[model samples]
Target: MVHLIKTQSSSAKSRMGPASLNPDLPAVAGLGSFEKLNGFFNAIYDGPTEDPPWHSALNLLCETLHAKHVTLILKPPSPVSTGILVNTDAVAHDATEAYQNHFFTLDPFVGLPEGQVVTPEELVGDKVWKQSTLYREYLKPLDVKFLIGADIQTADGIECRFRVSRGGDIPFSADDIALCRLLLPHMRRALQLHSRLDGLETERQLFAGAVNSMQLGTISLAHNGAVIDLNPEARRILAEKDGIQISNNVLCTDNRREGHELQRLIKEALSGSAGKKGPGLVEALALTRPSGRSSLGILVKEIPPSPWTVNRQRAAAVIFIRDPEASVAETSQKIVQQLFGLTRIEAAMALSLANGSTIEETAENLGLKKNTARTYLRFIFNKTGVTRQTMLVRKLLGSVASLG
Candidate 1:
């Protein structure tokens, strides 16, 4: 299934890498700079997006060394390409995204000869660098000159190799390669931190998704008693202070006593106890939205972790809201079928309406013709004696919405 067809490209002709690990290179890098770079990497690695701000670090390295520009080229996940990880102090800023998105897609720099030590004389001398397509599209406009690099074994994956580049007209000296060897530790640690931060962000999003998928009123409160997150059910109970702020541990008059109990339960769970996870004497919280109303019970549990991944010792608590009252589905059926005596299909249409779906959406989902859906709406109106969707929803919700 794998093929290695040779291409008559300039990079193919040059095929450069280190000749050998330099003897004078420091065995270990400085620890203080490594920690600082690690911290920066962690901050961005936890971002919601895949691309981290590694270019900034490369810029710092460039500034410190008085280099014109520095680029960190990461070998692609596949052997077919080279991806630019960081292009700091770039010359062709306009083409930066293009290089990252497309140029690197074909750059022959990735599949360069591995294992043996290489030098510029091996990869590109005078003629080959001028003819390479990647240099023309990415490096030419940027005025890139001298290029020195090292291929590192990536910690996570095989196809991934690390290379740092200093761009200029002058050729790199042996001392320059030694300098890079000195800085390799910082680069490796930075990448590892980025990997960990990415894991944390993914965990957060997964937790959020789990919270939303539950048929419960859930709220995540920060350590300082301020609410940081809320699902639909919990939002209503918190009364969403300022139309956005909501908390599980809210100090509202309606659920003050209950919120206090929930907070105590969280405290217990954080203090190495499971808290009252059983069906205890806690009362369900009332939810009143404009569409439907229901009651929600609460449960708290710890986020799962392996032995080494114990970052959340006293971090956020996972709140589970269980609707004791009828769910949104049940509420919609109760309102549309019981009150209006509509057929199950017609009741489903009305139920979908209650969930904020437009008529077209409801009809498409049920595989019913739009006109037929309209007819059912008419019948619902005639039976319930309500002229509009808003009125129907209001009648069911009764100032309290179901968390369904």
Candidate 2:
């Protein structure tokens, strides 16, 4: 049988024990008087950077409140989506799946007044709550008797649910409610931080993926000419030890003259001497490969220092290495075709010109007459809005097609 009782007011007048003295109550499981509060706050702020994100904080809350389960609904479930949920390990996978799959819509305990903590018995009469299908079918099966929840609405338009549940006859105490109320604001702020950081991380990954797709080797260098970071392509290039290599964590070439020129360009870039008219101070050189292949094209650009940064030893420059011998991947052709609405032959001609093939050479390579090739080139120029071959080449190289 369901043990139904009216919940007491969470208001200050009815609250008792140490919680009445201070809203932030001390831990009961041998924690120093203030250690639990300190630990919870730390976990709240550090939640955004954690691997599972907010797992530690939720676990601590479950333990401190002496509840069977604590859950943070980062994203609430809807008819179309399962949404994101973070909870303590006390909830079994099958139970969680059942709630998400079926019981979520049947839940009557949702839509609590914003930032107000309340129990089902407090929100609805004890008899109504006990007779509800969510209680008799779901909560009863799980052996859950008491539940307290609060809804948090963030400035970013996120509506999160904070829920705690326990079994047996003991209901949630006023202290538990007070502690949850105290921590709600901190939870909102931490969620905001997590949202912002998550967006920035997603953007970073997108740009990094685009660069990698183009097979562009990017290297970040410190102000002292030491290599600080390298993308996958850069690592592969350096690993080959072809035209350029790393020596003592510094980019260098085996050829003495080329190495001297490389260092000079890096120094000029660092000192803001590489012509500062554009977004980044820029200079370029070609390093001779010992394998008798095409020389590797290198561009050294100064990274503008952040306004808040005063240190010079940080990442101050970036180098871009492009190997002319590397054939354009086939995805680039598809992108060019879709971008300009070009036929296969027209797209091929455009990419050939972009890669430095002469009109006659492309015509012979593709087994087309010179006049026919010129006609196709004209169609490409019309479709892409470029007048001349050089313009077409520049347009193609600088377009999103390169991102493919």
Candidate 3:
């Protein structure tokens, strides 16, 4: 299970990491290139965000090194099925480019020593050279003689190597390897962030798709108070021209007051001093229209970032209407288990009432007397906050349509 990280406020002493985690991580302590990276992490919660920008970091390294070809391998030890993102000033990434098909498989110097800078031979020995005869034959024509490689160990010590090969008879000097070492740690961490961000983006898209398909009005806003995503129902509720218009994350709502209030909450969340990205909560927020109509029983919670790490960006607040007039709660006991913390008997009585069953019929179904069924109905109303059977049907409609 993944636990949500609580970031320290201005009033509290800051914690770099959890007691159980690695204390030496520079990113946690806000040091070095890590400081800039940490700032970027904070920026994610400040507003809507996309995948971690990878090529920019590579561009920084490329400008510093003035290398011919800078390839960031996305796969690990598996040569057969690994992704390679090659950023070269000389070449464009045409769809038909067969780079991944040829170079990675032909490259022989892999399995480098972890946490240490090295040259080609240092990583792959005489025995490897003997085995990679085909690779040598292929390299001779290109005159590629030098490779500066090193294994970048991650925060959890997950080891992966990065190598830059120069196309010349001249060998790579010690200075070149040293520079690679200097940039390796930053590149590795950036790559990890990129991976995590990409994964989160995918999940967000899928989840958004699911939400939009549902009847519930779901809206997810970033810390910056910008509309991140909204379900079809929500879009219908807020959309001005033919549903949604995307200009500065703006929406025309019948209820401008509610819209503005939500925006304020988002702004407050963005301004939070927490190093982690999340919306903690809103204080007594009231969503209303100019007509004085309001969305009631709005429940909000800060959803943590993805449990998986590698590309790290946080998710947004998940808000729902607890006692929805627009939706019906499902009769499924499993949903009852999740929502109201009700027992099986209580859930059954609620469902029966929602189905328009009288006390005698409910008793017949439950193998009980009318008085016993009436007793269960009383408990259900108390648990679900329904005053009568008609109100219970409204709860059933609004609540049952989703098990989110």
Q: What does candidate 3 score on TM? A: 0.47
Model 2 stretches with alpha carbons more than 4 Å out: 1-32, 213-215, 222-228, 246-252, 260-281, 302-305, 309-316, 329-335, 352-378, 385-391
Best by TM-score: 2
Model 1 Cα displacement at 31 (Å)?
13
In angstroms, give how far residue 344 of model 3 lies from its true place: 27
**Which ranking of candidates, highest TM-score first?**
2, 1, 3
Model 1 lDDT, full chain set: 0.54
RMSD for each of the candidates: 11.5, 5.6, 14.7
lDDT of 1 by residue, 248-336 (tens): 54433234565566666666544535534553543333323333445345566544345676453334555655554433534535444
1-404 per-residue lDDT for model 3 (tens digits): 11223343533323433321332332222223445444434432321232223444444444444554555555552455645443435334542144455555566666666656676566567567645753465444344455566666667444555656566455655444544554566656655665566679799778765554344566565644456766666655554332123458743334556656645544544454332443553454444434444344343445445566343233355444321333332335667656776788877766666666777887898888888878877887888788888887677656733443
lDDT for 236 (candidate 2): 82
User: Which candidate has the top score in lDDT?
Assistant: 2
Q: Residue 347's C-alpha lDDT in candidate 3? A: 73
- Count of steric clashes across candidates, in order: 21, 0, 18
Candidate 1: worst-modelled 10 consecutive residues by lDDT = 16-25
